[model samples]
Target: MQFFAPLVALVYLVAGAESACTGPNARTTPPPGAIVVDATGAYRGSFKTVSEGVAKLSTATGDSTLFLMPGIYKEKVTVPPLKGKLIVQGYTCDTTSYSANQVTITRAMAQNDIPASITKNRNDYTTTLLLKSSNVKVYNLNVANTAGNVGQAIAMKIDGANYGIYACKLTGYQDTLYANQGPALFAKSYINGAVDFIFGCTRRLGLSHATLVDFQKWHKVFFCTRKCFAQMLKQMKHILVTSVTQT
Candidate 1:
């Protein structure tokens, strides 16, 4: 009886350790009614790509959430205009920061890759994640464009209002994050690039505990804007702005 008691205690301890890693915000599992995306094929009946998961949301009514499993998804995702709010979250054991993020959406597309005659703005065409929907939130995923230091390549282009980007990493070589239109909040995230990395025309942008890094000689952190208002929290390091053209 005494030997069996130790085994019972060990089982409970193992169970407790597993439960400790899960929480409301931890996001180890998908939320109720969330569209699940698993690129690794481990989850049956789940969408195989991020794009497919987002496409499901286009026809979905009310607020929708897309939860991605832990894997590197090599694809570009675009969030089209929707009536309700949209949440795109990656699997993580710690939601408070992006360090524990297990999912990444990566693609390589440059401005020159798209034909100039097709669109007036080539920046919109080169983005890895293009958001055209309002009231959207992205959390705990690394969004990157691996287009190298060749011309203009965008990691993300957000043309949405009332959006929140939390605990994620956005990286590229040039023209990384295009905050084209926004009354948006970027919190606890990392943005890295070189040459007009965080360019935008956002009217109001809030940066709270976010890190921005530029790695090139021509270090122009920000570019064009129309009456831009930036709220930098105390935790934010200096924002090196060499040029800001008001339009």
Candidate 2:
């Protein structure tokens, strides 16, 4: 849970990202070799579904970028191991922060959905977005598992190396983000969960200038970070915590 200032600054580039989204679900045509997933089919060379776009790029050999239009995409997305880097961009009104993020990836599945016969950790099976490709970068997106506060439901699971998440929001009730392994950098983002929202045995995690929402109300509950975790507030960037009681 350590926040690296230099790494956070270097990972996110906000020079001209505001132009990425001109209107709701409106995006320019992606250049050659690039993939754009639009909910309204507003952009040329765009796939109507996120799964279709990701499936097509998972087999390619070179670098590619996936642009997601502003919409509530109710689907599970998995980026498999690929040869080149894959960049996913969520359309936002303002690219410099998360206040204007309109793209959301949501799924409703919990540990209860799995059979008890399986002897593995139930959290792994509740992930909505699974990232297994190296050198993957995601920006200004919101991922959520709407399985209520009943059980473990992971919003995003990162199993890739050299992954960077910028200005994104991850939400769930329990086991929100399972940073299984590899070094990951999450900057200017928001993560919310009730129990063990951030867990796993990762080598290193750099969470800088991010807001962590604690939906469960309990006094003096400090979560665990397997190998190492650090809290940092560089330039007076606070880890905004909001405590909510769920009935």
Candidates' C-alpha lDDT: 0.82, 0.77
Please give the RMSD of candidate 2 to the true structure. 11.6
Predicted candidate 2 versus true structure: per-residue lDDT over 1-247, tens digit per residue: 2478766665564534545556554333354667788899878777888888898785657788998887899998888898988888887766667777878999999988889997775666788999988889998899999998778788999988998899999988888888887678888898888887877757466777778778775321234542244431222245566787755
> Candidate 1 residues 111-183, lDDT tens each?
7788868777677778899999999999998999999788899998889789899999898878898888887
Q: How much is the lDDT of residue 45 in candidate 1?
A: 69
The numbered model that scores best in lDDT is 1
Which pairs of residues collide in candidate 1?
none
TM-score of each: 0.83, 0.79
Score candidate 1 by TM-score against the native. 0.83
